[model samples]
Target: MSSSKLARMAHVCVLALAALSWGAKTVTYDFNVTWVTANPDGLLERKVVGINGQWPLPVIEVDKGDRLVVNVHNGLGDRGCSIHFHGMFQNGTNEMDGPSMVTQCPILPGSSMTYNFTVNQNGTYWYHCHTDYCYPDGYRQALIVHDSDAYFAHDYDEEFTITVSDWYHELVEDLSTEFMSLYNPTGAEPIPSSFLLNDTINTSIPVKPNSTYLFRLINHGAFVGQYFYIEDHSFEIVEIDGVYTEPTEADMLYISVAQRYAILLKTKDTIDKNYAIVTVADSTLLDKIPSDLQLNNTNWLEYNKNAPHPQAIVNVSDSTDLHPYDDLSLVPYDHMPLLPEPDLEINVTVYMKNLMTGYNYAFLNNITYTAPKVPTLYTVMSSGDLADNPEIYGDFTHSVVLNHNDVVQLVLNNGDTGSHPFHLHGHQFQVIDRSPPYGPGFYDYLNGDPVPYDPNNHTAFPRTPARRDTVVLPPHGYFVIRFVADNPGVWVFHCHIDWHLSSGLAMLMIEAPRQIQERVTIPQEHYDVCRAAGVAFEGNAAANTKDFLDLSGQRSQPGWIPDGFTVHGIVALAFSVLSAICGILSIVIYGMADVKNKQDSVVPLDNPNEVVVEQNATGQTKT
Candidate 1:
């Protein structure tokens, strides 16, 4: 039997086993996170983070109600790791949310951390390493929560989890150094070397002639968003970011990083020909497109073994030329109405600025997020009555305290020129309003200043708004989202672009802190891992156990550059001026000395037309 066939049989067996238990049961995965080499793009072989010594880490599958226990042993010897189950509500299990220094310390090399949580949600989701640019190294894969009870489950004959990613020839560590350097003053994101489908180039998925197939498409890349489509075929969008949407027909979709979509594609009735599955990377997001880099990748739907599989003929002058269906127009399948007037509104504008070090950093308003010395969740668990105080989490963490069950509205204004896909942990929020809707006009704001959302002067919001964990904030535009703060945990709201995220484009929402204190408990293994990693398990952001308010030695982002002149800037300027003066003085002295030597050596000539030549330095004389 072929390895692919055996793999399919194994997947079926797991699904059958999961189905056998109607009631909720535990699904355990023992992952030994290690380094493995792979050349997915065929251009270069590089080290990647894999599970159980396997590249393209295993896809975690479980039923909707099953409890998932991922016991991760960080065998990557050189790096720390943590797993964030993207789009999981996590509810009372905030520690399991898995952002290092936010919920728990990183599972350091040679340490173990078990993520034990209930899979209460359904639809497509993913799991990835949330520690310091780790997922880009290949520590991510689709995490499917099987729902036999889905509304459209009976509509599709079969399903496939397809992942589209932007590939890089270099590792993240090297790229990060170049990205966060003085050379990258504008914070131009590194362009990808290639785009991939199912982690490889030119792959094919065999299909039946006239079958309805559910394709769970995930953009698990680090930086670029991708426009996805199938030639001569259109798909019905059924879900976005795990939220079931009313089936809307779309010929193409623009899936940003960390975003997901579930589409029902009906195959062509005739099996004589094959169709190309095309994914075009959003070239507008890149600062420069390398001549050698491929912006588009084509896989296929193989209907016949002998049919000619041809490459897709891309006609777009730019990726934006291909219009994608606006996700903001999608209505949730549940038809959940917008919540009542928000009890609290948090308005933040995204900014990109160079700090004192002259390296560009991303920010929310005037603050850039910096991880605290102690994990924010640990601080919440440790601070007796001060858990509700955002100060305990430190100033640089950009912490916001929220009342339990209060309707929270978040207005995100993009001050930067680039579009950012913002993702929220713990809850899927309703996208209430956005300007310059997702089409040809999406880039309209690039010609002028950013347009902030005006609550009173905007189009009426959808009665039943789209609810998703991730939404793209248009370039130089704004978006408003609302959700009930019912999930008590320290959830992060941040841009999904890994580069931006690494540069501090994130903030923590401490929702129902008092409830979090009462509901959540740190597992002993987590504490053990903290000890093994030499991280503080109980304390404030500064690790001060005595006084939560005294955040004296907490981690902080680099201070902003002051107007006019800073002391360091002035000193640097003075040094530069002095060096210039010295260089000029040396040149002048040499030129004057040369002139004097020539004048001293010259003898009077007998005739006016005659000239005297003399050599002095080498002790040679001429007349």
Candidate 2:
């Protein structure tokens, strides 16, 4: 072999050694937070949390049923903190719901909480700080809960845990506090200077030719929605929210905040080719926009800078030498059983309007931010009232009407200046379309009609159709989702961001249809009281009449009503017949008048008297 070939081999050998050391063991671990300066190499210095002095805490992999403990030691001297596990259902037990003060008390400074919960699920999941006012860069980690059979299921030749985060060179605390204190803020809160995909300050993924690799992807960015994909080659989605599906394929997958996805990919055999996984701004994901920005027609980038979008590329080396291991960690979907499906569709749209300020604004369809009311206004007010008012100045987001048994085709259309992760209450949806003309914030600039119809290009996310609680809709693009109206009751659907939902991005979905509601029996005393009080039993007349007849029938025969109620039925029939006759006579009279007018009109002029004016050379007209 030549010297250059030997050098290349040596370089690859060094990388292999690094990966081996990195991949040696996967176990559950705890981390204590420590404050560190962000933009250590950036122009604007900012502060963030470091895990045991590392920027990112190590990936934790634990088996199912294993009791996991996460001791989050709050190192920041000024702020209290807690961790919220995204997408983990712990039997509705509030003990595991790590809200800073509501579900559980905050872990104050110099203190920590040992959050214990069973690893009941097996898919992509994440953990992050739930403390308010902490910026997006404060603290977060990826927690991969492996299935019980994960070890013996498939032997992956190569596996990578690639995480994408939005990092800025500014203090999150200061930014969030400042924005909240503003009388009327315009655009989004400021973002950090850089975006990191897989720990690279600014880099892409490099792939070995003809080799496959498993990528366990996570989106822990505080608020931004991300799109994860591999250019050219498709990504086979194996799991989402830490649940395995029947291995679905897609060109790209969008990940909302607090959501995770795992994918398998095999690099192309051809040499010198590069594939890119990108996150552009997604307008479909935003809650609402300001009116002034809309007036000025602000572009997506000018409004929101740190949209959680990061991209990596797999580069194929063109040398004659090719890697022998063609298999990536992605297990082949050889003989998987078919899976069940969802039953409805919920359509979502992300739009923005310019507020009359120097700053721009956003909304998830129609919801915006607000402070939690004292005595909890939601306790006394109706759900409808809470949905109509905005605690902040943003657009409407929860503008959906759903009825039970209505199989939904939830389509999310991005009409805003930025991207948003459109999440639902009780289900996940199939992604049906994504067209391109990517805007500045990594949002897709695709068109869509208002109706809940699926576009043709996009495919379903893996394990999604099973019962997704959340799905990300790219900006400027629309997503088509189908779910069953299974859960009856008032459910909330909105952006997954705690602040966004708290603002006004949430609304209630009453699943009771008209017919089902009519079955509710009213007390006779209450009905009599309503009648005496002049309550018009307008819409309920049909049911009231039917009940009256049934009571009369019960007093008489099984097949006939009593003589007393029979006269009422006859009177109603006579009124109906008379009304029909009157309507018909009215129509006949109108028709006759139209015909008479047509007959009485004079003959139309074949040609009116034509007047011709000829202009002479001296500007004189001759007719």
Best model per lDDT:
1
Worst 10 residues of 2 by lDDT: 294-303
Q: Provide the clashing-pair count of each candidate structure.
A: 0, 78
**How well is each residue in 1-623 modelled by candidate 1, as lDDT tens digits?**
99999999999999997786568889999999999999998889999998999989899999998999999999999989999999999988998999999999999889988899998889999999999988998988999998888899999999999999988888899999999986667788888888888888999999998899999999999999999999999999999999888899999999999999999999988988999999899888998988998887889989996899999999999887889999999999999998899999999999998887778899999888898988899998989898877888898999999999999999999999999999999999999999879998999997799999988799998899999999999999999999999999999999999999999999999999999989998999999988998999888999999888898998889976779875456446656877999999999999999999989866767898986776778899876
The parts of candidate 2 lying over 4 Å away from their true place are 1-29, 38-45, 148-152, 177-185, 189-192, 202-210, 223-235, 248-259, 267-418, 424-467, 474-623
lDDT of 2 at 30: 76
Quick one: best TM-score, which candidate?
Answer: 1
Give the total clashing residue pairs for model 2: 78
lDDT of 2: 0.48
In model 1, what is the error at residue 136, expressed in angstroms? Answer: 0.5
Q: What's every prediction's RMSD, in angstroms?
A: 9.5, 23.9
* lDDT tens digits, residue span 21-82, model 2: 54233334577778876553234555667778776556667766566776667777777666
